[model samples]
Target: MNHASLPTTDLRARQARRRSLAFLLFVLVALAATLGGPVEPAVKLLDESQLVHATTAAPPVEVAAPMTIEQLRARVAAVLEREGVPGVGLAVVDRDGVRWAGGVGLADRDSGEPVTADTQFRVASITKSFVALGVMRLVEQGRLDLDRPLRELMPDVAIANDWDATSPITLAHALEHTAGFDDMRFNEYFSAADGAAPRAALAVNPRSRVARWRPGSRESYSNPGYTIAGHAIELATGESYESFIEREVLRPLGMPTARFRRSPEYADRLATGYDSPDQPALFRPIWHAPAGALLASPRELAELVHFWLRRGDRGGPALVGPEALARIERTETLPYLGPDTNYGLGNYGDVSHSARSRGHDGGLPGFLSAYRYFPELGVGYVMLLNSTHSLRAYLEIRALLFAYLTGGRAVPPPPPRDPDPAEVAAITGYYGYESPRMQLFGFIERAMVGISVRPDPGGIALEMLTGGGAALVPTGDGGYRHWREGGTSVRLTRGDDGRRILVGGLTYFEEHSYAWAKTRLFALTAALLLIQLAPAWALLWALLAGIRRVRGRSIAAGEFALHAWPAAAGLAWALLPLLFMHMARAEAYTTANPLSIALCACTLLFAACSAAAVAEVVHASVARTVPLSLRLVPTAAALASFGMTLYLLFHGMIGLRVWAW
Candidate 1:
């Protein structure tokens, strides 16, 4: 009998069967987890210094004595250490006096150079306040009007079409954020352009730039507008913007250390900014100067604040008249920041934890700074850190200010309300919406659950839930509206079956009906199931196996596994959505080892496939001296692979959730 004609134990069929079994095993593992299981938080890699702060309260004790300069220095130093900030400088000002001016930590951590009160730091956007003062000074000098058209000073500048109305852009418009420009443009104006020539380029291309809204129609903070306004002061006075500012504002106020230069004149004491502890060398001074570029010592900055506290008076011609200075204090809507906040001229005013406060925050390459004053409590604070992670520093300063000045009547943190059970139940289902028309919907616990929305060609999509109601997130308007699509409206209808939701033109029957509103979670679940081969690694691997077998006389299991390794990795990729969903859904599940499950699954799958391929070779062994007993080895190997796969599946599902729960 010719070997070609002999009934061939099909190796391909055996391999396919093995792969099918592997897939089934994968599904089983996923199904076990999906059905119901314990969940836990996944492990993460973080530095030892990255503190996990708990919501701990200070023990009952008398409020500390009125904070002295010495007390402030020690407190600030401790805070810098706790935050891993390389260094910091703080200045405290009051109605009658300045106190607690000092710095802490190494200006150069490696060199061990200590930071001092005079150590210079790029004040970042706090420079905007100085620029604002300069602009107002020009206004005081009758060189510019706050409410005049910016186009008048810089003829090349393109004023927004909306500002063409008789109420042309004015100093007030620039100060109040009514100029139809935005933050980054202002940042680029100063930082992007080194000197006058590049700034002149900005004046010509104003229309292509992004604006928060039409000028005077909305309250959008415009950083570029201030820079432009600063330019206008230069244009009108025939003086460079920096020179004009120094002559008009900082010089008159005795803030000698303050200057806007490409590089600090005194680099020895300048605190080197840091991106992070690990990334120590990401510092560059390109287009960062206008918005956050000016360098000043804490003492100089404190004096600047003192000038404002003294109502811009230096016994000579005031930097700004009472009326102009008052504009800096008046609240204007802060659309760029948030609806709940406002800015007056260059200063920020907001209600934090429900207490009214005023301040400006600045962040740049490696520095963060804030200067806030509570007029009601007769206190002010300045915080400057040589690291980007300055939020902790900001909070510490706020806490200190609150403790010492507000008689320890801390602004109460917002109370947590138990989630709406009925709403949760209604929003537990999935829903969808369209885009451009840019719509999205999702629900959970009978209320809206997930908010992750992706836009499709015509609209957007949401997940499914049990309830009929779904949220409609409109991408066009940049706000979510609750409405019914497909023609139905959201109105509660009482029927013989009880109350049901009617939304997007469809009346969901029984509130958990098939035609209920879709949600983000439901969309995501459906997409994951429908599009399981996304990495396409599995399909790609199978195809490659076929191609390799055709291309060569034989194939190596190791080679096949090498090419298909990415597919093995895809098994884990497929489970990520499910893992995240379970994590979010079951709050008790604090940690889940997705990577472990993936590794075990890949190994089991790869091993089973390899065992089958080995068996195929063994069954048709050329030597035939390979005993029938060896065939039993393949069976045993298969059984072991199956057993391991099952174990991983069960643990991945039931064990994780059970352990976490």
Candidate 2:
């Protein structure tokens, strides 16, 4: 048996078997890559600016001077003119009533129609606040219970939870986005059919409704959660969610002008939305009608804010009691995040303008709106913008309002208090984002937002995945009470998997070991470099193959398959996402659409080609005689393609049907 390593034929046969086994493994991986789910990541292909979100600091801007109502209006006009914002609606409120409510700038640019207090704009996610109000109203009336499991209420709606026995999904969990459901899928995002009921939104993509974690354990914002709640409202009452809101919540709170659909009144006074000052943003009729489809003016929003200020009392028998209103503002689920002041029912707690504020920031495509109320000071403001890119203008307007409201009595945060070295060491590590708003984009969020807590002389430096960091100084009670920017804070705990966790104000981060961090770094570097360079290598081989054929020189079958298949694989990889992005922008691209079918087909084809390319490489290495130079690039291409296939397989994206998924 040891006769100088046996005969060459025996050795060759053994190598061929190993090659066959590897090729079979590649085929299995290829099959696995074609089955991705339908969750959406909100890829807006029209505007190029939002594609990059580099650094995030506290949104509130500090001001040096207080202003009168006249000064605030003048400053708003200046901001609109300078920043090229089409229009803005502002409402200021105190304990007594709305102080001022109106608009500044043109509502319709072409006709020069001036914006007024009645010019309605889409309030996007601010619609959730109204949903909470309706639920609380129902809760008080003894029709709906927040504590009852969703399964018992609506047995028809599809929901999958692993912990159904011990902890079932409740109305409170869904309203708070703690039901552990994934956000709406790609097809659901682009499902823009008009007059579709709240129940219709449920059928868009039900597979995404499966819980990713235990119910009520964490908070991840989801539009579908509110829509589901809307359907539940329909089940509880014999009418639609809009009808219920209008009857029980809106009219009772004295906001008769607000409507979920584009009624005749809403259409007449609706402000034209803008991507910028010059570019008009067309209205999208997405299925998240309950979550993001409220059309209300600054004046209507004033009434809504006043309802909160008055604590459910409207001068006639109290609609919803003070305790229910208090429960709406309290964060009871995630005690680790902010205890009593985080994302409660619908209105989240904030510390903008040096004040503890409870509000909601509504951002969709065309319109952006905000509702910030200072409960302690008995004041609040609602600001709405027609243009999506007018965040700076919004901030400026708020800062001016903050100055006028505070009257130079804003309390500054305590400065530079460092924790002990032992405490810093206990908390320092690589922490990954665990609870992502959108499950589809969780990978990207994990990569970009991962933080590293390093000990500093005065405090600890909180460094992000993308390079820059902030040196955080501990001020309040030590351990997790240390304040970062704004009202953001962090605490250490354990995830359900029992991994050490760093719980922040809005995000949950699980600790990553040092070895895992190094491995991830290496993988990231390899993926970035290879995905870019593999195509180049394929391109070079393509040119050579073309030249060989032109000169009438016969190319080997093994060599041709090795290079050619990988080139096809690379091309498919590049075009699939681009095609999806372009297709997603329009309403034509539904799950049943041909383009959606084609996209899935292309993804499957990509995996097949990658598998074939790798199989050829293995076969050639064993049986055929290819030069090192000829084999190197093609091998890299095959490996790179295979790596991507593995990624797709791992993420359940292999047979990704955009429309159906």
Predicted candidate 2: what Cα RMSD to the true structure?
Answer: 7.2
Clashing pairs in 2: 33-654, 34-654, 34-655, 35-654, 35-655, 36-652, 36-653, 38-661, 40-185, 591-659
Off by over 4 Å in 1: 1-67, 159-171, 178-182, 185-198, 201-212, 262-265, 281-283, 286-288, 312-317, 331-340, 353-355, 405-533, 536-661
Minimum summed lDDT over a 10-residue window in model 2 is located at 46-55
TM-score of each: 0.55, 0.83
TM-score of 1: 0.55
Q: Model 2 over residues 194-303: C-alpha lDDT tens digits?
A: 55687788887887788999887777767788888888788878898888888888887778788887887457799888876787777777787887788888998988
lDDT of 1 by residue, 1-661 (tens): 2224434565566467557656754674565456336543221111100111000111112234345556656766777787777887877777665665677776778788888778888777787788787776776778777666666666666556553664466556666555545434212322234444326545533542333344554443444555676667667788777788777778877677777764545867678877664334334443424444578888777776666666644353477788877777664322221221345667755333224456576666567777766655556667677776545565565456445545445444223223333443444432222100000111122333212233322233333343232343231212222222111112222222243322221112223433433433354444334223322534554575578678863443333332233333334434545544454333222233554344334445444443443444444354443344432333333333333334345434322332222
Error of 2 at 423 (Å): 3.5
The deviation in Å at residue 449 for candidate 2 is 3.9
Off by over 4 Å in 2: 1-66, 81-83, 190-195, 310-317, 335-341, 390-397, 407-410, 414-421, 475-488, 495-499, 540-561, 587-589
Give the distance in Å from residue 517's predicted Cα in candidate 2 to where it truly belongs. 3.7
Query: In model 2, how large is the Cα lDDT of residue 250?
Result: 81
Model 1, residue 57: C-alpha shift (Å): 20
Which candidate leads in lDDT?
2
